[model samples]
Target: MNFGFLKIAAAIPEIEVADCRHNTAEMEKLLREACQRGVSVIAFPELSVTGYTCGDLFGQPVLLAEAEKTFGELMERTADCPAVAVAGLPVAVDGRLYNAAAVFCRGKLLGIVPKTYLPNYNEYYEVRWFASGDELKTDTVTLCGQTVPVSSKLLFRSGEVCLGIELCEDLWVPVPPSSLQAVHGANVLVNLSASNEMVGKHDYLRDLVRQQSARTVSAYLYASAGCGESTTDVVFAGNGLIAENGVLLEEAERFVPGSRLVCCDIDIERLAALRRKTNTFAYAGPSPAFRSVAFDLPAYGRSYPLLRHYNPTPFVPSDDDGKHRRCEEIFDIQCTGLARRIRHTGARTAVIGISGGLDSTLALLVAVRTFDLLGLPRKRILGVTMPGFGTTDRTYDNAMGLMRALGVEIRETDIRAACLQHFADIGLEADDRSVTYENAQARERTQILMDLANRSGGMVVGTGDLSELALGWATYNGDHMSMYGVNCSIPKTLVRHLVGWIAATHADEATRPWLLDIIDTPISPELLPADERGDIAQRTEDLVGPYELHDFFLYHFMRFGVPPDKLFFIARHAFGERYAPETIKKWLVVFLRRFFAQQFKRSAMPDGPKVGSVSLSPRGDWRMPSDASAALWIAQAEAIRTDEP
Candidate 1:
């Protein structure tokens, strides 16, 4: 396995009823093909050695003896193969017949897992032929001249991948055997099925596989019988699927003419990480002991193709409808959260600083929605425009126009003179234009907003978003601190999208123009003086790499705890030709250093409802050391940098 990914396949080979020799030969061919393609583990349909529709032939001594001989040949022929193969057949154990999947790896029989649940309903009568595993009197059984462990609690292990087996109807029951296997330590579940084709069954079966994999936090490989089976009474569609954590990685098209195989790489590390995070998934004490059969296989190399598609923008949905709906729901969450804060604090006015930037624009919109939800007059919402030294005509005009359009009580609090005076008082030259100068302006504007809110019996609504908080872009005790932050959990990339969405769908015509203009403007804090033409001089992205890259880094780093090397690999693949490896490596280094160095800023962040699964709320989702070291993470990224941008 490479980076916790195990290459697995679901194989469906053509078979004939009661023809054990032909069925076994077909399975052997598929096994060789799958193994050649680097499949570490492969699964075949239930009763594949002897067709599932064998009827009373299953009880005939001639059919049983032939199946035993064919199965032995299959095991011997595949003994030297590196891949682990699971093929289903009927095994006679101490006078009782059991439907079992015999796992083979490295020239030896690993174990046999029997079907737990048998269906006895319409168009099915498994109980008439085979006995469920629950009736087993002993844990060990003699099959094909080899004594092997046989039970429902058999877990096969090859290196890091733990394998679990379940039969067809076992998954259709209320509680699948795979569920307990997962909780007991199975990270990969395989199902051998012979489900008959019917109307609308594929959709339901697909959902079952997806949901079971997700609920168990394991990778599921399902292989079912195909069209070559006796179609006298029913047709087998040969549905094959490979799913991981509710996502279908790969699946075979139904009703294919020949034998089929679907393969994909399953991220076992991701599953283990999620299980570790979810408290309820912790294994309960004293479960049935698994008889593990250890086998050896070389680790997968980097050349193995990753069949999974990693979304470039994990935060933003690709579809327009999903994006619009997301914006609406996030807007409601912000408004409802702020409204509750206002009602609980008994504040009369909603105070916010509108800078004509994406973060501030989103905050102001939420403030307006909150007042409207509370049935308060629009004038009661105070929108403050605190123009600093770097303020430009375009942003200032847009800010003033938005205020006028919204009809909120707008106040102009220019901090140019006040900041200069404070800079001199602190013995710092305004011409220096360093962090001191920039922070002086930010602190001055924050002071104006806070004092005004106090005087008006209102609260200072913060505009700093999750992206800024992640990089510590906001000045400490200045834009970083607030009474309550409405945009705290939203990333800068999403902040822009949310603003544009509101302009297009929600904002009135008069206010829409200003909102669009704000979205078009460059993202900046206006901390420095403008250029000769009076345009923005200090773009945030120019200083700290693109927000798009930073947001991508933040999501994978925080949400999945992906290591630096693996994250770099995924970024190179996701960005494709858009960004070179060196560029991603550079920003990845910066993101890690900033994320660790800026934990002090996030340690005291204000209350904000988490709008997404990934959040940096110190009191809720994330809690990190203020002095955590970024040396190791940075060194790893720097090693991969070779001037290839």
Candidate 2:
């Protein structure tokens, strides 16, 4: 399936000043090339037919006549191409000339959008030759023996993609015509621009396109004038940009010597989903003055190669600089939240359970930072290591080492004896490692921590991460219950990175190695005993599937509300090299089942600061009924064929 993706392009063609014939030929060449590559809509630079630098020649009847004839001929030549084309030219209506972009498909003129804003400044004198399209007296313009709708409020629609056009200086104005077009149901906005290159103008121009796409929640395609334009006063770099919902998908290298095009696929469905989720985008109804032009394109029912990149680890940054920055920011948020809670409650001590696993290590680090921020002694933060039936010596030693290095008061309490007593009281066999047997140990550890906190007039800091909460991987009222959850919204994949950041940036020489070793250790609750080699026997990933997959599923599902089949499709693309299709499908099923079945846990989850877009805080970002059925979601997931290409 095409999966709601629409391929769009920004074509920058070589041209000569006032050479309509040569310019039209060059545009046709790039048009056909882009169509062959499956582009559904392609846009060209402003006034491309007669060149933006034609200057006073724009008023010459000969140049205007030739531009119209040549553009008509160009359309006729590319009539067989499937892609809809938007090209800039000067249009004459009611005895006045206006800068405009013509939209056409299959040799037919769809509409003409006049430039609403004309620049009359230091480097520009557009008012000398052409009138602002906003002042046009007629709604229809006759060009090349054809009459078409002419207005600044026209939108062209083809299947799921809707096109809106603005020319040259329109985008630089306070209120671009494309903004209204978007609010009137335009999903794709195209700007045919002839902006000249200035030292710092390129970066500012990119920012404009990016921010506009984000604000309108639409796909934006920008095509600018190239090197062939008149260089008498300024240079045109022929910049082409394609952005979707705040992200710049493709940016052509500026100042290239030849004709080139930048193309990428935009997720139309995702944009629609975001618009619907945000709700405010639909509040303003379509204006009565706006008109919709309908056209046809090739069917997008079949699958094609995707040009977009899907980061497999969405929660974790893919670059080192971004990763370090994100880790530091998240650490600050965690520490800030913890510090506020300690101050508000006036708790004399900050009590935390220090397991050698990733979550507890991060929670401990945040507590230490919070204590330092509050100017409280490290000894006031109690670090308890409760060794249960499954705790190994490696985790125990690392826990002790980290606590001591951080100058926190370390306390060790063996929970195996209490768990065995509880099993005896319940008349259950200690050898049976079932849920009851495992949960007894967890409850015992929590009880000890709570008693310790009560004795010291402190609060127990929870260490369960977001991934565990999503999968319902914690024992309810056991590790899942706490006064405040510092690591509650942090996902497992990010927890490791935060700890690693501390080890690299903040850890002392004595503490860095212990933090690094804790990161290297496998993630587990250590609820079950060690194996024959005294290593962890119950690997969490082996039982509940990889934390990486679960985190990926949670981020997309919650953030974008992507349904199961599409999620599977993108997951396959994102991790195709690292994981087999069957493996991803298997764990996807597990993630869905657990996520739905575990809403009860999240419904009663402890209060924690929401640090990201995807959070399960019942009182804040997410709120779902505890008994919501997963039947429909599971059915959709199960219907996907792993063998399909």
Candidate 3:
């Protein structure tokens, strides 16, 4: 098994109450199937050997003995399966029986991790038939054909991954054993649960898994007992989930026997780097206060098809209902923020520059929304289309038409002569195309917009987005400075899709046709003149690659602090034949370099609404040094590019 990657699965197989033979046989089928599918680690539901709803049958001497015997047979059947399997049963230890996960691999029983907490309240009366790990006396027990360590402190170690397993009530306690297991050197966590379904309980379960993964910064695998159990008192609704860091990879439907097996290659190298970067994560290894066990898997060089979930558009909400909800909430945030600012400043009108581009279009829409909220005249929203040296007729015409149709005060101010005068004032040669040449035009436009706002007693709304801030793509004192930024938290990738949503659902046919056409247009600033082909020039992706890819890199790297090598691995799987490695590598290097260099810009950003979790606003999420070095990250990325995989 490769340490950098290993496939893990959380399976919720059908179970039979008080039927060890039937349950073990069914589990064996799923176990062998998972191995054939190339899963290296597989976890089944809690108490699957005898079932979670066994009630008084759990204490029956005949049932316990039969379960123990069947557990031994399961070990032999999955001997050469090549997957570490975890199944739960009750083991008699000292004077009490303990709820335990019997970990088996390579024709031998590795260990038994007992449940740390026994729930006695609500629908759970686990204390009736089980004892907590704290009450255990012996550390080793003889079962089957070998002597194995049976304790809650046991951590199973393979060459590829280090794992710790916990049971149902163990995770619900305030101090979960999983947290200590993570601190004692476990990189991946598994939970075998038999939690009963209740109204609104699924939400809490999801949040718990997400929080645990985030708290430990490790891959989490959780498998819950399914519907085929003794429902005499409470029903088991088969909840299963797989999460990495805090993002949910897959979640199973409750009460349905989908036999969920969610698999993803956990990035061990990235976990190591995150632990290295954060000083708070403590490592252990002096004394044996915590027990340890080690096992080796058979040769794990077998190839497995990619199983990681890929959200083609990670920024856009995937569910139709979720997308609608987010759009409505985002509109409200922008509208309320702008409305409050306008009211406090006593500005009766709002002025915005319109380029018919996605960013400005979004800003103008927000302005209209704010005016609508204030019960003011739609004509108070003044939109100006300023044609310049590189202005194209398509964008200019669309910009004018959109403004006129919105019933706003539409104005036109050709800035070609005004920009030339500004260039002379700055002693910059107009023929010499450089930052000065490009930024002079931007500052001139900003000046006109700002002056128009003052003349109309309105506020000039900003439109630069989150991606631009991360890349430092905005001109200083030009597009960078404004009274308020309406689309600051939205990424460039999402902006396109959000505007697409409007075109499809909100705008009329007249506006919808032009919006779709603009969506097809090449993403550009239109700063440079058109080519001899009479088409718009100055494509942005030609200089800075696709924003979609860069935003992916940004979300993973900046949000999770994932290492470059692992990030490269994930991208290779996610993008497959869509992009050449050289192209992805080129843009990855650009993203790293610009992300590090652009911190100074984000550190001084003006007040803006944080509608997403990965915002760079100083008061919110990200906090990085203005001059942090990218040398190590660049080196790692270059090494990946050079590696002969």
Candidate 2 lDDT tens digits, 249-287: 899999998899998988898888888888788565545
Between candidates 2 and 3, name the one with more favorable lDDT.
2
lDDT score for residue 623 of model 3? 84
- Candidate that scores best on lDDT: 2
The per-candidate count of clashes, in order, stands at 0, 0, 0
Quantify all predictions' global Cα lDDT against the true fold. Answer: 0.88, 0.89, 0.81
Residue-wise C-alpha lDDT for candidate 3, range 404-505, written one tens digit per residue: 767789978988899888778878886877877778778888899999999999888888998998888888888886788888888899888878888887
> Over the stretch 23-135, how does candidate 1's per-residue lDDT look in tens digits?
99998888888877788899999999998999888889999999988998888888867888999999988788988999887557878899989888998888898898989
Residue-level lDDT for 141 in candidate 3: 87
TM-score of each: 0.94, 0.97, 0.84
Q: Report the Cα lDDT for residue 421, model 2.
A: 81
